[model samples]
Target: MYGGVAAVKELSLIVCRGEFLTILGPSGSGKTTALMLLAGFISPTNGDILVGGKSVASVPSYRRDQGIVFQSYALFPHLSVRRNLEFPLEMRGVKAAERADRVANLLARVHLDNFGDRMPSQLSGGQQQRVALARALIADPPVLLLDEPLGALDRNLREQMQSEIKTLHKEFGITTVCVTHDQEEALTLSDRIIVMRGGAIEQIDTPEGLYDRPKSLFVANFLGEANLLNGVIPLPNDATPTSMLSIIRPERIRLAVPHAPTLADAHQRQQANGVVTEVIYAGALRKYNVQVGNNVLIMREHVASDQQVFRPGDQVRLDWLRSDVRLVATETNNGVE
Candidate 1:
């Protein structure tokens, strides 16, 4: 707790061996605080942290058997790339010859063998990030901690590094815990994602599961675009309780002219009519905001050569498979371990 307010409360999770787990949330959602707690940077007021079945909650950061890659890269500016990678091994009392060999192997592994003599400032942002990752892995620690590791790069570079990180994770098979607010990053890299809000876990599931079946309204909207069907439309089936709300993805909606011929599978689809209120032309997809009754429902479709495009004021019909709808709680629950 900080300043008498609980920064993270009743948070409990297990990081399986060789699993890539991501803690995802917006600012002040307690994700970073949780990472700090795991890294031994701060001791929890009540609770224990177990690594390899041993309690290490009170251990200092330096003594923990884990590697961390901070957002800043945190390379020593005065040292060469090779020396930076060697620092951890040196501190662990590795012999000079073994340290040199390990540094060389890691440099080559990160595609920086020829640049080992260069300083951190002399390298580009991507290259420096690679070096930081290499340094983190040089000691072969059992767990790896990443704190917004890709926040420093541009869009294209970040994509490239994401692939790189995924490949490295596959190769090393290390148990990794990453904390970030980027939904795309979490979805792309994690085997499982923990969505946190208001200092509590909103949900924990695989990326596909979380996006497809969020447990609460906050998670449904936060992870991706969700069209709340509550008060906007009637459910095709009445299986859901009144306390829950139905939601559908924007891409699950299909749009057509109001008088278009009925689809072949109309028997299994639910249909609605609305006037197009807005049309947004994204490069690869079309986004439409259609006003049905008093609600504006969003619909997305890939831009295809033979597809009909609707504009504002156009009458459109939206349809989706009856099974595409999902039910979620209207509010988040006070989570437990």
Candidate 2:
């Protein structure tokens, strides 16, 4: 009903005290809307959202006692770092002496103690973001919400801040929910991740659960790169398990050398023979597009000091453990949309 789109539909979520949860999805996938609902910025069309076992359906945003850090640093440019950190305390009317003590502690916590006198414009992007985080935590709110707080920084700085934010969450033990479209960031920061799509909840699990055992095709493809093999389920054998569909990850697929030990001979016949079509060097890993009959499958492996190099237009045999090929429900159409 908001943003001219059905932002969230039939969404129910609960967060325990002091848990780090992340809402992750692509743009327009309703991640931010869900965050807004929890933060009391927008009301839900249906269903109730509870915080700490209490319903906050009609709670006003200001009274929610939640701290939020936005994608943009959203710092007051005219205010010095110290003033910015103290602004929340000032509004809350904490005693000046106590405010100073809290400010000093926070400055040390965020590693911005000496830069407190500088204005927002004077600090670099990373420093400004740290200040924003410090300001949000100033009030010691029950819950912390972050909306793509690292989106503006360069990649290197963004990675660094990710660790800092994670450390802060652990140190403060505050229940936190972060919204981001970045999968890697979500996997890095969240104890549990909620994957959303088309105003609906797709999957909610620990990072490894979402990646290793996705419930649906949408979840499999959205969380990471998956080589969805479009093949009918083979009957259960001594080696193969009976299922409807197979979901293979690129990194799980392996290449075999002719003279090397055979997986089938080793009682590991979970292998597929394919022809290599394209090779891509991705710095840390090598990606290969392999053609298995009419299906093009992806394979990935880490860069090795003495790695075997393969080029396009070479026939290669790909093998994997039967356990690695996850059996997923077969659908008539891929659920990408």
lDDT top scorer: 1
Model-by-model lDDT, in order? 0.92, 0.84
- Top TM-score: which candidate number? 1
Cα RMSD to the true fold for all candidates: 1.9, 3.0
Per-residue CA lDDT of model 2 for 263-313, tens digit only, reads 544565476677789999989989999888778888899999997888888
Each model's backbone clash number: 0, 0
Give the alpha carbon lDDT tens digit for every residue of 202-307 in model 1. 8999999999989987888889899977766675475455668888999999998988998899998887899999999989989999999888899998999998
Segments in model 2 whose C-alpha atoms lie over 4 Å from true places: 3-5, 232-243, 263-265, 330-337
Candidate 2 clashes between residue pairs 3 or more apart in a chain or in different chains: none
Model 2 is weakest, by summed lDDT over 10 consecutive residues, at 328-337
Error of 1 at 298 (Å): 0.8
Candidate 1 has an lDDT of: 0.92
